[model samples]
Target chain A: MQDARIRLFSFVSLSIATFLSVPGAVLSLGWLLLSPGTLRETMKSAAFWVILLFVTIIATATQMSGNDGLSYFIRTGVIILLGFSVYREWHPGEYLDLSVWLFGKKAGFDIGLAVEMSIQGLHEASREFARIRSALSLKGLQPGIRLIPAVGFLMIHTRLMRARDQADLLATRGYRAGGSCCPVFRTSNRDITMGILAILVVFLSFMPVRDIFILQM
Target chain B: MKLSLSAVEWNAGSWKFRADETFTPGVHLVSGRVGSGKTTLALLSARLLQPDAGAVEYEDIRSRTLSFQYPEYHITGSTLHEEAESYGVNPSAACARAGLAGRWDEDPFRLSRGELKLFQLSCLFMRQWDLLILDEPFSALDCRGKLAVCRSIGENRSGIVLVSTHEQHILPKTDYLWEMRTGKLTFRGPLPEAITAWESAPGPVRMLREQGVIPANLTRDDILEAVCRMHE
Candidate 1:
């Protein structure tokens, strides 16, 4: 959805549904799959399969042989798919705009700025990890348990240095505790339809659908 | 021994880099503007990054090291002493050589960026490598620190050292020069020839050429001597 508010609302409503009811969770996944190209992109990630396998293993070990195990696996899959869908559509700028629109300019701006910085820090950390890994490889050292401390220290050190520089820049720019930003949003008919569907899914989760919804194990 | 790229093509995000050049056993200075793929070429030469289409061949190379643009990325030590020791070099000696004699016991993360670079350089210099790639090594250093690094580079005769930088004025005495323009290796030749032939030579070189004085060498000292003689 182009509208940040609608997207956030839909994500939150779907998250609640996934946690509450199996049918609701399945509906949430279906809604997530409504976005074109999401399913293909999600399936392409090896991480998604790994996580699914891990959850399946846990379910098999704990429940052994029963409908409960199968249900657990299905629920876990639904949750994972919901998360993947949310991440695929995540936009830092939209989050910032939504935050600023919801909260007053000052407090909302601070929160939004923090979110933006966190996203940027994630990118930097990934790049830094690659560089550090390459450096260690060049030194004839394999990345094992021992390298964790060094990598962690370097990442923390870099973040601290960046924070210091950012502080200096903020000071130089005469930044106050609360800054203001103009919040703008554009909503479409599709966004409104998705938002209503998300609300309906959350509402459906509260209804007792044990008689109607059944999964053969 | 030589480190050469053969029609190597690499991509960084949306930008594409192509390099086809050979670096001999000498101080080779790779100069280019920002985002001109100098670092990408340096990484490829160091074998840290593989090319998408071609090969980076190392002729009879036993060991190699790549010092990244940010020195902190190369640091894996907790303390200054341990940082040097991690490279299998004497901590005290490396610290002293890096002009960080009294800071051995301190956390390396506490030191300034330039000091960290000096410390890393000292450790790298202590070991023998067939290929040394320094990417923007002159950055975040004082004049004396820069001079110290230049002296180290000038004194070394062990292996092929590739210095990738955009700093034109404070460059070391390089034997050969390579210029990257818009992701293409545009020039590769002797230093003197590069200074005279390169259309986008540094300000000092262009100024000297404009004044009808071309130095016999491309080092700062040689240029200064030539300019002094011109005045005399």
Candidate 2:
């Protein structure tokens, strides 16, 4: 579809997902409004409502709502839940982190926001480690595989996410319509790029980042 | 650094692949008839699909790489670069590799199928793997893109490159060949040995056998080139 439609659809769907996530949202929906889509689509998209119900429960059940940024907390919470719902419904079985709120606030940029959150997660991990390392030290844990993975998750999480998007964009460029690749490598610009890419590959191979920054989930 | 070790084991439906086939450290072409286990083989090697009763000896393969036939399957990020970064690839570089040289920050779910494939393909090739398994790597490639892929593999294709294809049109420079029938892996010696079989292959190979002037056995490319030459 058009870009506008796609963005609008995603935004509205995300917004509704956020609203529905509050504990009272579903109850409110039961007594309030319905989206324009068919009943099936609405039912399929119960994440927002679910989040609303959850928020209602948390607000009523606990005094946390009176803490701070209740609306902000709920908004960020809803967005995170909505993003998660989109991911769950889309791929069904893939594992990923809920990076929606890891980075404070994002205006509109998608990839940018994800990157920011990954870095934030890394920072948070560092803080968490410093805060809890002494406790673990007394427990006789030797800060081995666990320490590296805690930092690595954020890196792997962001990088692989970026790669997947690149794969999707190849489709828009009109590839594989009549099958892909030719037997012999045709000498062209991509070949030149292939050479440069070779150097980069060599660099990546020598790096020990795989052990340090890994995608655990 | 390496893929986890597991073997293929199964006794189900129309699919079958041998266990502990021992994928070597280079590109391998596993080809056979239509009913052969090409896609199933790729999945087995990549650890994306589990075998009936075998172990996948995946060694040292962290989550830096992603395995997906359909790009839609690998999408876990809310946006495009987010997806690439999830696989531990540079978002900008991944987008460029997928032919999305411009749309660096779009949602991965928003891109078309072809675009998604390119992005996934690049992300796949971006990292050095213990093994890179492709069922049909060239099923969705343009001439230039395919050539780029060929050259990329030629230069940087490290570890095991396990592939299965019937199309033969776009073939990798293979050192070994494995033929699967029913569920057994009919291990051929090398590409040359497989070429001998293809050259003298009974029903279909016979046609290209007569036309075989080139050394390569598979006629997908030669035949197409010949046909195009004849048309010209």
Candidate 3:
């Protein structure tokens, strides 16, 4: 969605609906399918597969323990899909614009700046991981189970160092919390449509399955 | 030992790179503008990346390595000692070689960028690789670090050393020249003769070529000698 506020609103509502019932998850899956390429793009990430594998293991364990694991699997998987779309659609300054538009200058700007920095940090960490892996391969070190701890340590250490550097830069620039910003948004009719649908889905999720079918008819 | 690219093609989204060249022993300086696929070429040459078509073949090249553009990317350890050991080099020896002696306990990230770069290069140069690909090795270095790198490149006598850089002034004596134009790797042939055909030649080299004098090599001394000869 072009409008960050609407996109976030839809995401939150859809996540809540998806978590409530199997029918809500089914509905959320339909919403996810509307994007078409989000699933494909999310699938391209190795991290996605790793997360899915972990979820699968937990779900399997739950099933073996006589719980409704299938429902849990569907809900979590759809939530992940929705989350990926939000991430993929995010522009650098969208959060700042939305926050400022919603909460005004001082408080919103500070919160928005923190969120922006955190998101950027995530991107930098991902890039760092790729470069570190390449470095390992160049050094004739193969990636296996044994190197996971070391790799994780390196990744976390670098991220913390980078965060510290960013903090220093902000301090040097005399930034003490709030900043001035003119918020702007370029929202489309489709964004509004999807947003309304998200709210409707939440309301429908709470209704009886028979009532939803009757209402549909 | 040799590294060869035969009709190799790699695609990254809309950008495409194609190369059909063979690199034999001695220093081959690959020069190109930024975003001209120099790093991609280095990675493909190092076999870190598989081409979408054709192949990159290594003939008798048992040991090989690729030095990344940013020195920070290669760091896997917290301290200088661990970093050296990560490269499988002795910590004290590598530290001393990089002029970081007695500072093995220092964090690798705490070192100045130039120091980190020198340290990384020093660790890599300690081993003899049949093929060594240095991608923008002089990027974060000072003049002294650049000279040290050039000196090390000069000392590698029996390997295919592919130095991909746009470094204009300081350079080791090179064997062949290649240029990456757009996304294609074009061979400019052996040096001296290749100097005339180097479309993206460095400023000094181009100036010397404009005066109808091609240096025997691309080193600082070679260009100065050529200039003196031009006056003579």
Candidate with maximal TM-score: 3
- Sort every candidate by lDDT, greatest first: 3, 1, 2
lDDT of each: 0.82, 0.52, 0.89
Top candidate on DockQ is: 1
Candidate 1 matches the true fold with a TM-score of: 0.82
iRMS, candidate 1, in Å: value is: 1.1
- 2 against 3, candidate with superior lDDT: 3
**Better lDDT candidate (1, 3):** 3
How do the residues B1-232 of candidate 1 rate in per-residue lDDT, one tens digit apiece? Answer: 9887999999855789998878778898888898888888878888888799999998998888888889888777788887787788999999999988878998887888899898899898888778988999889988888888888888765689888888766778888888888898865578676677766677888888888887766667888887897787
Candidate 3 chain B weakest lDDT stretch, 10 residues: B69-78
The digit string of per-residue lDDT tens for model 2 on A138-170 reads 223455775564335434544466557655775
lDDT digits (tens) for residues A1-217 of candidate 3: 7888899999999999999988898898898778787667777878777888888899999999999888889899888888877887888988988888778898999889988888888878887788778889887788888778778877877788888998999999999977889998888999999999999889989987998776543
Model 3 DockQ, alpha carbons vs. true complex: 0.46
DockQ of 1: 0.62
Name the candidate that leads on lDDT.
3
